[model samples]
Target: MPILVEVSKGLLTQEGEREVFPKIAAALLEAHGLTGNSFMTPNVIGHVSVKPESECFVGGKSQSLAVVEVTVPAITFPNGQVAQKFIGEVTDIIDTYKAKPHPRERTYVVVKHAVDGPWGIGGKAYSNADLGAAIQKAAMA
Candidate 1:
């Protein structure tokens, strides 16, 4: 999984940025029923990018907004409904951390699916089966 969190400067406190990603990562694992799967832990990566409000746009106008984007393999979510639920949950998490409360419309969350073989780590590529086997092995240990 790859998580990208982009926020207007001052939209989130420094402490909030520090707290959000780990919480989001954990929520993702829980959503997938993969909590405590060590193989998955190392694969959950995230980054936070903050830009001045003038540099962030909404409707072609600059605004203070936070955007959370996650990219995972298509198999990660069983269906569109599940993906919607995940998006709602992520929005709530951001709501809790935002410096100023914003409507759901202001906090944008996007989920993108990467076709399996194109997702890579280090210099190697991993298929869904390879990832599943790694997670299972880690869970058993």
Candidate 2:
């Protein structure tokens, strides 16, 4: 799984720049009820990038914006409600990290589901069932 948090330069405070990645990653794990799980916790990978405002645009105009793209297994986000909550939480996380005067409307979040066959790790493609087994195995450790 991969989570990308991209923001226009100056969108986040200096401290936020250093901290938001882990915070957003934790939010994702919590949303999936896998927070602190030995297996899942180690698997949630993320990246945070700051882009120059001159290179960032919305509707053809330069804008300071935040975009969060999280990719997960197909079995995740089982329903609209779950997806909605996660989206809102991602926005809130951004709001918490935003520099003053950064508009909440500029925050964007997207959750993409990768079909099970391609969810590979350690040279092995992991299906949904394999993930479940892995999680269970870790829990028993």
Candidate 3:
């Protein structure tokens, strides 16, 4: 799982910019009720890119923006209600990082699922069944 966060430079406080990555990861784990799952916790990772405001855009116009794109296994977000709730929670997490109040319209959250069989960890690819077994094994450890 990877949750990519891109923010317009200066949109978040210096401290917030430094810490948002792990915070977002923690929020994801919490949402799934697996905050301490050793395997899953280490697997949730991402990159935070802070672009110059001039490079950030909305509707093809340069603007301050905060975008969170979460890419995970297909089994995640099992239903619409679960997906919507997690999206809202992620939006709220990002909102707290803003240096100044930002328009909610500028914050975007997207979740995409891996098509199975191509999601990789280390050098090996994992199908949905493989991932489920790995997680279950980790939980029992």
Candidate 4:
């Protein structure tokens, strides 16, 4: 089965869209041993989208955060443990990029998944520690 990975909205700064996305995508491709036109293959598809934040005022004011969505196919292994390992591997990549210092201060990185058929993997909200742990676990797994 194919899997989709999506980045959450408001998770990325403008700089992230232009800089982080490509680097992350490329890292994923390399990790999977995929290159060039291989990104078009059916088993995996990586996508990125962004939504603007909104605000409203009622009795109180509420603000909506912008989000960035990244979707990629999930790679399955023979067992649950292996599957988790695979997820961990991908998660590590996202974490690494999230930890890198950037020019913007209002940026975050998250992972999410699709609920129905053609299910996608979501990168969870990541901090440097979270990313580091995930990377170490995946690498050691």
Give per-residue lDDT, candidate 2, residue 96. 86
Span of ten consecutive residues with least summed lDDT in model 3: 85-94
Q: lDDT (CA) for every model shown? A: 0.84, 0.85, 0.86, 0.40
| Candidate 4, superposed: residue stretches over 4 Å from native | 13-43, 52-76, 99-141
Can you rank all candidates by TM-score, best first? 3, 2, 1, 4
lDDT for model 2 comes to 0.85
lDDT of 4 by residue, 10-122 (tens): 44444544555455555444444443432132323445554333332223533322223334333313256543444455454444444233222232333443233323325
Model 1 ranges with Cα > 4 A deviation: none
lDDT of 2 by residue, 1-141 (tens): 799989999999998888888888888888878888898997888789999999899889998989999998888888898888888888887888788677878899989887766567778878888998898888788
TM, every model: 0.91, 0.92, 0.93, 0.33
- Supply the global lDDT for candidate 4: 0.40
Name the regions of candidate 3 deviating beyond 4 angstroms. Answer: none
Ranking by lDDT: 3, 2, 1, 4
Question: Model 2, which residues run further than 4 Å from truth?
Answer: none
Look at candidate 2 and tell me the lDDT of residue 40: 90
Q: Evaluate model 3: give its lDDT.
A: 0.86
RMSD of each: 1.5, 1.4, 1.2, 12.3
Using TM-score as the measure, the top candidate is: 3
Candidate 4 has its poorest 10 consecutive residues by lDDT at 99-108
Give RMSD (Å) of candidate 3 vs. truth.
1.2
Estimate the TM-score for candidate 2: 0.92
